[model samples]
Target: MSTLAAMIAADYGTIGDILRERARETPERLAVVMETGEAVTYAQFDALADRVAAALQRDGIQPGEAVAVCALSSIPYAALFLGALRAGVAVAPIAPSSTPGAIAGMVADCGARLFFLDAGVAEAQKPAPVPARQIALDGSAVGEAFDAWLAPEGATPAPVEIGPKHPFNIIYSSGTTGTPKGIVQSHGMRWKHIFVGDTIGYAHAPVSLLSTPLYSNTTLVCFFPTLAGGGTVVLMKKFDVVRYLELAQTHRVTHTMLVPVQYRRLMEHPDFDRYDLSSTRMKFCTSAPFSAELKGEVLRRWRGGLVEYFGMTEGGGTCILMAHEHPDKLHTVGRPAPGHDIRLIDEDGREVGPGVVGEIVGRSASMMNGYHGRADKTAEATWTSPEGLSFIRTGDVGRFDEDGFLTLMDRKKDMIISGGFNIYPSDLEAVLATHPAVVEAAVVGVPSDAWGETPVAFVAARGQADPEAIRAFVNDKVGKTQRLAEVRFVDALPRSHIGKVLKRELRETWQKSPTT
Candidate 1:
């Protein structure tokens, strides 16, 4: 037996250890591949991580210190992410799409000693005063070239004793304008994810195609599992439907994780059926509300298991709806995963029974350590049970069916209360989407003199549809209290990078132009 293989056989607890083992077990297997055709073998991938760790150590980055990277998905970015974990350094992956102020705030918040970014972000974030020394990942003149900054070939990183509580990476909450709070996920949390992947066929050395940005927790849930299982990860810097179909056909990708909007686009594509996706073993969706209609379409047309995960990035409990297995339960996000405890509590923090709409609180083994440097915020987000077990409050309002399936109503903050009547925006949005002339819709509560608050809808129409006519149609279908007071036409609804509708933006726009 190989020496490295024997070492890994004893125990491969961490991600870096798993990479080392995969290099020894399948040295020539493709570890990562870019949409542009750049690829790396497991052996080379391990070596690159080692170099990154060595360089950070040489620069006096202690095990607990952090580094930040803001760039598009690429080979070097992926390696640097894993390498930092190897050196016991946490990574804060800021989105390049974020405003310059948000980027600067995150870099400062994480206390990053070295900021690694591509030329594009460097150019965009000029004069933002990044506190750390910069290293250019794309060899741009904005900072030192990545290759030149890396430790010399054949260099080795000092061994790091990674513990369960060690910070793996800091994922900032999804927001484009503000400096979102950083969620500090420990190595133990990630290990749970990898283990969960094994149960769902991620251990088969699958070829996974990923289109989501590396900065998202939505991507890492799939990305880390594929790599840990010695599978090849094919990344796209940006998502294009035709390009995605072509890569899936060419690579025979076995697994994928796309947000609901991406799936809707693929299913609605003109030639979606022409692509051969028979090799797919599973397709996962998360990060947004997936409508039952879209899930049905995917199950009918796509050739794989369809699973929708309902949870938060802060790592509370997760509910997995295996769509193929539970066709009748398409409206519900499945039961809480094994060993995960999910509960519902009223506004007063008292536990509510099934069939009652309340805030979703969950507890599990795979929870985040806390919000970085925000103890008050962390405490505010947590709810202590009678047994003193802390649960993460999801801020989502949902109810459990008789069979224990969860049906999400809407975000707690988004629920509209008009004259003491509670109205879920999703309920109104669902009816609006069914209108023949409407492409999509969003409903937000607007100020009202009589009702205190009233429902108003902003819709993206298929073509020239009369706003009054559509509003009348919807009001006729829903109850008087649930009816929309006004309908405004928009070319498109504002969305975050992960495809969540920015309801705050919609509300702000309405407040600015309250002509109606």
Candidate 2:
């Protein structure tokens, strides 16, 4: 395997360099299209980005500063992102779906100096600590719009020299908890992961669908790889079933990086076959795996490259199942990508054999520097072994097959041990989702009087899923202990922006409910 240095031998030093190089190479290539239906070519994007950088500098945001963007997917957003990178500023993408308190916490955590707000969205979203100024992305103040402010009079800000180690972003994790700590990504890992993504599992994929929100680390898997390869990005503001299929066909979308629920929705769409998906080549499912049954359903309808990966934002875009390599078909997340060292170790930190389910650990050029501003958590996640490998504990129970395929069995903290049997929520959820009427399923261990921890099933049904039928369905499929103690037939499951069923919320909700 080539070293990361060899991989980046001809690399551009910083994000600014990549922007300039793209502009020089393909000045007229369409770079981004906004929600308002405006398109900007490479030349236009770079120029306006320079203007935003200068405008920001004029407002006292200098190199290496932090900026919070509380806007929806728009043309102005693309410009703002580029400008932040060009000006050597870090970006925090605050989603509209987040509450005002959450937005404030994130912006405050990143310590943004100035926020470029889209009032319609930002006013609704209301990012915290509200930056020094709130410049609008759209709407004119006395006929002077954001673009007019960027009259291109000021020269592009001088490039700030950055090593691979300089921080690129302080991305917060998806789940809203007590406080979301930032994930610090280094400049080195940012580009390294992009390159690894292009060659490891996905090639220079053209026209990837951004149906998933732009606020995720998974978004990095889609957005940067295409941008680096000079391919087109088919952006979607939100998930609309028909629009997804239509755009995929219209743009001849070659790739899609989405969560499992999104894939399930695509397959369940009434108008699934209304457009041709022959051009769709790769599908990436990794923020929680879709059931193999769901993958089969998806492939049956849309058929293309199907790959699953297992990794967190903290782990970087490091682990993957390469296209066309199907060994442990449904169980494994596949082998380690090049330059990544991975292992499964027991509780005492000793290496476990291939079949022994233990905690998965890894190290790579792509691992985050550390979780931002939390040393104790950082120490818990990342540590160095005697052999000098920078090991990161995945907190996922996994094992490698003799055939070298890697499988995730369960999360260490998420496992339910009852009556001497261990059960993974994913395993139970998979069994539950296969039932005819189950639209969504979340399995969490609730307190049990007899067993230390016991599994309870919470389901969101589609057409006719009542508690009895669904409980019988799961009981018939999984082991006796895996059967739900009680089932909650809720109208809908709590979901994050990218649509992973928020089991944490469901667990809390179920705890308070007398029915469960």
Candidate 3:
């Protein structure tokens, strides 16, 4: 076998093992750096992780148990995550933006015996009852400070056998009212992600800046691999366009991941052209809709390869758009990634032909094991092929072009139905986006007495544009079935933590309006 094949097939042991190897190979190299001006070398980070693992074992954290971290991004958070994996424990990194009730409920649902929180999160959630012992990531008067909770510096935990089937982490899905669904990703899945850069020229000492929250899977795609590849990762507690640019220039950052909204903010920054980003090698965007215009703008101004990834936290299939290489396919999400079997199925569950819109379903080696403790929900999220292959259902409506590139047409739940005709909100949104005054546009279905449901548009504009005129302009461009029933102007669209427009909030606001 070739050297590359041997590396791919070799057992990487565990995340802990990888860190140990890097520490041994490059002890003095920086492993992690935070915006707070604190940095840790590979040897220091590995030792801290070992101390964390030893501490967990000393506290009776058994193998396969869940350890929940509901805190802001910090070096301790990173150490805890890797340490949990070293102890054969699965880490559940809950979103800090989540409400107190939601956080408490998720902690209970995950059955985590140990909970870690930041000072702010601990204070906000003090009213809510927590079952587990709480440790504070930041030095706070919470349950215990992270420093106090660590084992002795030289202590080592008992080794536990780890296999591919072992759960590495459980990423809870966002936008849940009650307990969110925990997507259980196996060690093998993460291992695949770690080595994805082997053939992509990531072996070089790349510096990655993680502006998105660590709790998000969007950040992990680039964060984890950079570490496993012995690269430096700069962690930003919160994203600021000016600070990001300064850091990128100072560190000569080569790789980073940002959501679409961040890209928009960076591009629109007053001093966008003032920074030197020539050292950037690869930039990735995911977690929300990225308009072709925005992609084109980034490609023109940014000094690196821009790739867009379309997939879910469930990890069924991934579509990668190398915008630099395929400029013509900027509007599409590119073709299915290698080893990913993607298919579009109609409402009746029959496979659709090219150019026919359908719901995307796919099977891949990296697919999630299942939603933790929710078999029925897991089954509902899965689909079986005619040939008995299991696939995860992505509730996205899209079509494949002649070149096998996928063009998304709004989400299935967001599809507007008027006069018994299906209307994709993306089509209408695209028209609204073309308006010179519009900065961002979103379309949501609202109840209508005459058509059962009708399309309504919400836009953030650059100037005081008349909503009625904008609505009429969009209506003239779209078909009669897809015309907007109403248009409203807002300073900004309500977005999730990861930049997804919350159309449901728009629908609720519209329904509550007296004029409606």
Candidate 4:
């Protein structure tokens, strides 16, 4: 078996070193697989990644250029990721199922220079007016059928030094108040996260099944942490409640990162009893806090094993519920990860003692270098401390108990987290505002019996706008989670001049409205 070149070593200067090292040592090891049973081993993955880099270089893809992967989660998607990073391309994977308008907006916002997409999307993508080197994934992307171009036909990418300070990727956050901002993450930022797939649970656990979208930060923060230590990553192309349980029993999967909604679905799935989750050693739930009763149900179903981790895309983890911790504390996100100093501070940044819920502020290497091109937002989020720790102001509201475990209370942003998905009311508002009949729009998370918090839109229209029409517009335009459960028109939208729609006011008005 051809292993990754042992001669190549990490000098701590480049970001691609991670995959290179893995490829060098265990080229035959499975790096990633798809539901169709296609697999990419380290050597093959590396070679394919090399092809992607070569293709980019053929057109003079300079280091530090932004390359966006518009393909779905597949072997090609993985190649584009590692290949781009190795070539010093800032990676951002756009959802292929998304609408062309949203995709175009994302491309324009990120300034993507190259696009790797499927033939079905190529024509639709070209009209987006993006200046990019576009390529079709079908004929050229690496897979089992294989592309001959994956073999070196030209000079291979010369290893470049990626530093702790260099930006590795830029993932967009749905701006609840305005246009979505790209959060730029650095290689140093990712390496500094103390907990993830590899961190030892009180007792060692193995065999993790990943159901989170590979592009989401949860995958990077939870799964990559394990891959860093050479842990196996079992992929599920998409979540299927039946298959999820079967895989657990079949593989004896010990670890997984579950969203609260997925957890609820698993808990409610009829097939859960047909298989054995008894082998599940540790389960970490995030995106939103799991209820105490739900935690108990999860522990009871999985046999007393459930924990939680609190984190965001813009910063490192706030806390983790370790296996060693209390069951009563299951609802709490345990103390901050090492190297992160977490605190609950009020509006002025004054530290609030235990039990006072406030926006969580944390400092760590896992924090973003900055929100890409949004300097004003970046300065507000990041603060340089005299002690040398760069503190990240996490926008969520939570507090530490006397035991040091964190209790999540309310969120400060109108960010609707449904099924572990963040749906920005403002992003939807912006999309809806473009409608000719729409005079104003406000989105809020109404109490959902199923999805924890489902987004509902309240609109004021000048002429006429069908709720179903608006929902269809957004449903086709965004990720599945961003879909509105329902839409209702109001007489007027409450706004605070500067003409900003006061989301909090709208939320309260919706909560009390008879039409609600």
Candidate 3 per-residue C-alpha lDDT over 362-408 given as tens digits, one digit per residue, 9 for 90 to 100: 88888898999989989999989999999999999999999999998
Model 2 residue-pair collision total? 2
Which TM-score value belongs to model 3?
0.97
By lDDT, the candidates rank as 1, 3, 2, 4
Evaluation by TM-score, superior candidate among 3 and 4: 3
Q: Which has the better lDDT: candidate 2, or candidate 3?
A: 3
How well is each residue in 279-308 modelled by candidate 1, as lDDT tens digits? 999999999999999899999999999999
How does each model score on lDDT? 0.92, 0.72, 0.88, 0.67
Instruction: For residues 104-131, write the lDDT of model 4, one tens digit per residue.
Output: 7777767786666665555556556545
Superposed model 3: Cα runs more than 4 Å off: 1-12, 176-179
Off by over 4 Å in 1: 1-12, 176-179
Ten residues in sequence with the least summed lDDT for candidate 4:
2-11
TM-scores of all candidate predictions against the true structure: 0.97, 0.90, 0.97, 0.73
TM-score result, candidate 2: 0.90
- Sliding window of 10 residues with minimal summed lDDT for model 2: 1-10
